[model samples]
Structures are given as structure tokens and as C-alpha cells.
Target: MSVDLETVRRVAHLARIKVGDDEAVRLQDELNAILGFVEQLNEVDVDGVAPMTAAVDASLRRRVDEVTDGGNPERVLANAPAADDGFFVVPKVVE
Candidate 1:
């Protein structure tokens, strides 16, 4: 795909970017180079490669799921700006 000055101008207009004719020519060259690099990257062979989130081999640490009250309600609500009846109070929104 060839990126021309007209395409650059149209892209700039769609993106709401302010670019003069000289800037558009420069942007055209840059966009063309980027597309060429992407074309080269698309030619790589990865038939059996597995998708990975990170380059390092690390596993996420997980614990067994258990359901219980956090055991310290007063400590958790200590920093609340407004608390009432063991609950954080908020302004009533409905009439």
C-alpha cells in the first residue's frame, strides 16, 4: 500500500490534525515507511508459535477461593468520611 500526500491530507483532516502541504509530504514518507515495515513483519513464519502475554516464563500466584466476612469491619470503615450502623453512609438520592 502506497501512502500519498493526498491520503496523508485526508487522514490528517479525519484525525482533526493541522498539517500544511510540506508537513503532509513528510507525513507521507513516514507513513509509507511504517507500512513497509509492517509488510516485512507480515512475511515472518510462525506456524507453531504459541501466543504469550510476556517474554519471561512466569506464572501468576493464585490462592484457593474462600468466602468469609473480612473479620474486621470497624478497621475497614475507620477512614470513611461518613459511616452509620456499620455501613458507609451516603446522601439519599431519591425523594
Candidate 2:
């Protein structure tokens, strides 16, 4: 999984990034180091380990599903350039 200068140059070209010869060489080394770290991580044993979204388990806070008026319809429509019958009035595009 080692990255070469030519591969780094190609990656830069595909990413639409400007990388000079020296910068490309540096990027090649950096990419190789990152790949090496990922390879090291692949050696770890995780058999039967459950995937987790957070470090600690906790129920997500939620509100009961209920219908309620948001209130302040006039305030919500105040910023509209044109509003009719509590709705935004836009130019008719279809005949």
C-alpha cells in the first residue's frame, strides 16, 4: 500500500490540486505513512465486537409525536416579499 511520487502526482491531478515535483514527493511519503497506519489497524482482532456509534450507551432524548400549531404565522410571513392566504405567492410557471 505504499504510494509513489507518480501516484501522488496522479492523485493531485484527479483532485484538481496543484502539486509541484517537491510537494508531490512529500505527499507520496505522507500517503505511504497513512497507508502504513491503516495496514497496522487491519492487524487488530475484532471478532464478535459490536459496532458502536458512541463510547457510552444512552437513550436519545426525544419528544412524543403530537400535532401542535407553531404559532406566529404573521411573524413567519413578515419577511416574504409576497404572501397570500398565509402562503407565499410565486409567479405561475405552468399554464
Quote the RMSD, in angstroms, for model 2. 8.8
RMSD of 1: 10.0
Candidate 1 TM-score, true structure as reference: 0.45
Q: How large is the C-alpha RMSD of every model relative to the true structure?
A: 10.0, 8.8
Stretches of model 1 off by over 4 angstroms after superposition: 44-95
lDDT of each: 0.88, 0.87
- TM-score to native of every candidate shown: 0.45, 0.45
Scored against the true structure, residue 57 in model 1 reaches a CA lDDT of: 84
Residue 48 lDDT in model 1?
97
How well is each residue in 4-95 modelled by candidate 1, as lDDT tens digits? 78889899999999999788988999999889878886678978988788888888888779865687889989999999879999999889
Whole-model lDDT, candidate 2?
0.87
- Cα deviation of 41 in candidate 2 (Å)? 2.6
